[model samples]
Target: MITKILPGTNIELKSGARDADLSVTGVVAMALPLHWGGRVTVIHAGDNTLYPLGYKISDPALKLVREVMNGAKQLILYRLNTVGAKASAEVSTGVTAEAVFPGTRGNDLSVVVSASGEKWLVKTYFGTQEVDSQIISAAADFSPYYVALSGTGTLAAATVKLTGGTDGAVESDYTGFFAELEKREYNVICSTDSDRAADVVSFVKEQNANRAYVQGVVTGVHPDSEAIYVCNSTGGVTADYELTPAESCATLAGLIAQAGVQTSLTYHRGITGWTDVKPHLTIDQQTGRTQNGEVLFVPLYGSPSVLYDITSLTTFDEDHPKDFGKGLVMRTLQKYQSDLQKLLDTRCVGKIRNSVEGRAQIKAMVFEMTSRGYLAPGYMEDFSADDITVTAGTERDAVSVVVGIKAVDTVDKIYVTVTAL
Candidate 1:
């Protein structure tokens, strides 16, 4: 052997790490008692912004937040304020203060100032309960939820109660809200109001088409839309807060956040521990509505629980039958497609050629998922090596792939027959 200078080859081993990031996260948008507008924020478990409650809607997102923190690993929140809402305010001798945000929650604030030694004691009250107190020698030192102080007038022995804080007619800034939401990724999107139910459903459909699939849960009935789950909740007034159809939607959002994609909320409790059916309906009504793809919170074992895990899909097309209307099946399909896309991006993009090796890689991925039960075995019944095709596209520097997938549906019902022997 001749000892000649040779170049060394670098060999590296690489593998793809599986991620469940999208499967365990959820997003909810609603009116909150915070700075208004279409402001979007992310809150994991134990965030202080949701603390020191003061308003009735203080934790407007309390239902969704609590469930996500306890169940789902992450959550995205949107605080929506109606356009042109007036902030509540109180004018005192030496101080002028306004509510932090525009909402009827501000009308409940009361501000009182008293002399304490060398400093003036300013106290903030939320419907008779003192929530904040500050010692101040001048207006600049006053900071409380009841008011934002200003001016040089004497605050000594002065009390001012807020009034005229009208909550702007409830209007949803769907245009702004959706614009902000589309930038983020989430497993589920939940909203209570039906005002923009069509928009929400349409957005989810668009996301799916773009290969960024997301599911939605809504309250009240909406026109049939795939990937959108509908639930009919009570619109009755309760002692603490009115149980509107929207609030019902929020409750379902929280439930979905905690439960796994493979898990069903059927027979699960509503977020508020509410177990009794309000505006009480008979069994026949609940059954009929659910069969029509309405998610009802009916009494199960004398406890309030979800009636079914259904989607707003009533397709009559042969290609997409009613059986594919089930929420569980759609979710399974979404996850399956997501995995396939990931494989393409990570394992096939530039490293693999659009040849036999590339096709084998695609087939191997499908085999792995099916073996692990992510995809049903039925998919492999007639699927041969030719089932996966990775070919060069007509477009410059483009490749195309064709894949066939089959999903196993959740066994919602079963019929059994027995005869006396």
Candidate 2:
């Protein structure tokens, strides 16, 4: 059975449990963090805590968050350092007001001070909408939700627009983010900054090499690696917002994370709220880009849809065949890898004896997980008990297992022949 563990941790699977029973699918991590609080914030489906935490609807970070929430059930928002300066304004002598959160979103705020009889009325406006207001005799006693007030002096009646708010630098370097992200678990990690495409790909490669088993979605650059998915479309327009290529990358990441083992992204699935794709390409262009290992969005069956669910791996070898380029197969393999790792880390390792009986027990566990967990759920086909092998390892305390699985993929194309009689 699937059980909820600690607050920050994802669901854990009990022994002999089906991977689909407790599989933490669609867990997405956002490279950018909100300005309001904490270096990391975990948002679950239908969670509106961001609004109460001072995140505005118009914030650019929220756009990515909203798009991710459209598909993925959970999102981890991480920030490296206190990147931006807070917007502030001097109302009068010894009286100052600062935004509750840092970043360029604060620049949209303005503070208006009006006389209220013997007291002072301070109002915080986000583009003419009063978000917070307070009336008090002194600045120290004034408490507002949107802006923090400081200093002690006589308040004057004036309107001051907060300035000097900046978004800071794009996270082109992932040195800090990777250090912390290594401790977390997620199905997909997305970079919302297209300029950092190369850096993101490099990070994903290193993480995968270390057996992190996480997928990455990035825009612009093509590394031709199985660990990374590249988006090449531009000028996307959604019903609620105009999207940059980077934003579209985040949306795709969410979709990839949410897709179950039985589903394919290109299975007649369109973006949740997309209205149009920019620089519409012809059928030949779509085929050319798909062959180049780039993901593209085009009009399909009268709606904007992903052209193909493929990765950036064009080069193929015995180990990495052409079918490895299919995103669905890769996701299934990664899920198995992650599940096996979790099983070993949690149940075996130093706890289990390294004897023949112990090895057989381990083999049985793997067999059940492979057949009952994966094959029975239609995630894989052509699996047999003979495909799993368990033996003692070269080390005295280690055991080894070899498993073969054929992942299932959705049918996206059909061919029909008509003979006139």
Candidate 3:
């Protein structure tokens, strides 16, 4: 008698883990690459201050960082090289010093060497303030925080100021930034350069098509796409700070990033750290701007608040309803899509078999996940088990899943009637 050989039973375990939080804001700016040597750096919750990260207050990126942190806790900064010149100075014989980073801010740096008895005192100054000082016995033992040292020799007492530093030309093409940005997950992106409006719109559209679900915030130019938010307010000067239109875009991006799926940035949503907006718009002006799909900082309830959480999507078809223009609804939809994709990629993609039972399992899993994650939190409503369907595709290895969801929106308007008897 011959016995047939059988394949061993394989048990694949699936994880019930969820994706990372979707509340990160990305900033693409022409910033000096100081301590972080790479093109990208992530600033955690408490480390939002630029001075601690080797960035002076005079740096061009300082304002952008401050504006973004005013609303968001976490930030991912993309360093756009300006092709600028580095500031350097020759200090005494056999010693040369250069700014730690490039750009015009380095031009404010100066190196002063003074004789310190048995040792040498090297002081690095930013204008009149002495930022860094190191007492060293020899050039080889010298280490400075603000500048890099080269060409070692006997130390001498002299003062040398950095020169020939320039900001150079800002990059017009954002192909590289977009490529690197796609590798990471962020809810919103904004650039300090208003000139990159068209490129930013194109990037947002491509990303949304791929289901990446990121929004772009810009100023001035109007690109009527649901994926883009245009800030049209001609900024304002507060008591402590003055903002331009581009800076306002960064602030709006931050606010959008911090807003959860359950919240809407309308009426009651006020910009953090800003008390008022200058040159307030009239009622008619606000109405006209809103109709044009522009976001404005208007006075609401005696405070500077968002007029409406709107996107530049004036032309809407049946597939893209008027609700799609609302930032709150878009956030809810993007979160759901991103989370579902993550669930499939992690749990169901290669592990599940292409059978009726597997399809049923997928549908049940998605329904339960949505109920617990979204419905329970009030981000979504009117969802039922029938809203999700998983079916077999033409290819045996492929599966098609269709999900329908009703995102909950905030009540921004009310009408009341009073009759006197």
The TM-scores, one per candidate, come to 0.70, 0.81, 0.84
Order of candidate numbers by lDDT, starting with the best: 2, 3, 1
Evaluated at residue 177, the lDDT of candidate 1 is 65
- Candidate that would win on lDDT: 2
Where does model 3 exceed 4 Å of error?
Answer: 1-41, 48-61, 79-81, 112-123, 128-144, 157-159, 192-194
TM-score for candidate 3, residues paired by index? 0.84
lDDT per model, in order?
0.61, 0.77, 0.75
lDDT of 1 by residue, 136-247 (tens): 8888776645467878876667787777665454444467667776677677777666766767787778888898777787765665766787866443232344455566
Candidate with better lDDT, 2 vs 3: 2
Q: Write the per-residue lDDT of candidate 3 for residues 56-91, one digit (tens) a residue.
A: 433444656767766666677765654667788888
lDDT of 2 by residue, 1-421 (tens): 4465656656665676333343468898876755554457788878865433346433554788777887888888776535678888898988888877676667778999999999988888876777778888888897756688899777899899988765555454777777778888788888867777787788777877888888889887778988788887654677667777667887788788778465788744468777877768887887888888888877777777777889899999998998889999899998888887777777677777988888887878788777877899899999988898888878787667888888988886799999999
* Residue pairs whose backbone atoms clash in candidate 2: 26-257
Candidate 1's C-alpha runs over 4 A off are 1-24, 30-80, 84-94, 114-121, 135-137, 141-146, 152-157, 219-222, 232-247, 267-272, 278-287, 336-392, 401-406, 419-421
| RMSD (Å) per prediction | 6.6, 7.1, 6.4
- 1 or 2: which has the higher lDDT? 2
What RMSD does model 1 have? Answer: 6.6
